[model samples]
Target: MALRIRNHIPGLTAALTILSLAAVFAAVLGVIPQSSLPRAPEPLIELIPHINAIISTIAVMTILLGVRFIRHGSVRRHRAMMLTSVGLFIMFLILYLYKVILKGPAEFLGPDVIYQYIYMPTLAVHILLAIVCIPLLYYVALIALSRPIEAIYESRHKIVGRVAASLWLISFVLGNVVYVMLYVVY
Candidate 1:
């Protein structure tokens, strides 16, 4: 396994929670402008979506490879994918927070009722759960690394797959939707 499965499940879970919350708090508190490097990279909104694309690709690969590994009973590769996906996600979050701090809040497309009711809720949930998923995602990955073969292939393990897929889908889809609205309509 690429990631060693900690027998101390509770401790690992708690550590994951703390890590995610710290990142969220950092995002919310607003990094000082001086903390950001001006010469590092100007915020390129156009290139940003590519990061999301990469993440979505990684997520897809992880899910597919994970399923395959389980079926074939290749524990190591499955563990690799799990670790790789989590690494990609953490990298995504760093870039995301950097982008957000560099630019500020999301650009709303419209103030209409439809935007308020439909768009806002979707966007809010997308962002919030994306943060929450940080820990859950890692936990799922660690489990895949640690769990027994029988458990790995079970429907129960698929629960983690479902959650990962749902969160990544919402994040990617809503991201594209918001991007389109901001750049095209608003």
Candidate 2:
């Protein structure tokens, strides 16, 4: 059954994306009871934001390297880099969800004008772009994995990949900015 589903790349990608999004939404909404979740030590909870920020920074660099490799026609290297980026992103998400579940959302401590006009809008856009990138990244990844390199060029991979990469990069950058604003500046 797993093998059959694996052969059906589109279906598998869709399933994975749906499941990932559902998990993220559930975490954000605190749908899971706090009593059911294990508590992280205060020290570990305190370290989560810094760790996630570093993961985001590494993901951005990995993505940039993946783009460079693909542009230079290094398909294997590009694939490795992209997979690394995805793994790093997953790590970031897990840590973030854990922190949010344990500590709840961070309160922005900046002034009203900055919070309302600058931070809020930037955070909103970052979240929106991250949401938009999920299915797109999955689709492109499925295409690359299920088909031959040559076949990917014939599909919508390039177009979708470009859009996904751009959005993912911007989202990560904006996330780092949000982290700084919440943790450092404010």
| lDDT per model vs. reference | 0.65, 0.90
Q: In each prediction, how many residue pairs overlap at the backbone (N, C-alpha, C within less than 3 A)? A: 0, 0
Clashes of 1: 0
| RMSD of candidates 1 onward, in order | 4.0, 1.8
The C-alpha stretches of model 2 lying farther than 4 A from their native spots are 1-7
| Candidate 1 residue pairs that clash | none
What TM-score does structure 2 among the candidates reach? Answer: 0.93
Report the C-alpha lDDT of model 2 over 110-152, residue by residue, as the tens digit: 8999999999999999999999999999988888777767778
TM-score of 1: 0.69
lDDT (tens digit, per residue) of candidate 1 on 34-95: 36645345557556656665675666567577667856877778767767666776676666
RMSD of 2: 1.8
In candidate 2, the residue pairs with backbone N, CA or C atoms under 3 Å apart (3 or more residues apart, or in different chains) clash, namely none
Minimal lDDT window, size 10, model 1: 31-40
Q: Give me the candidate number with maximum lDDT.
A: 2
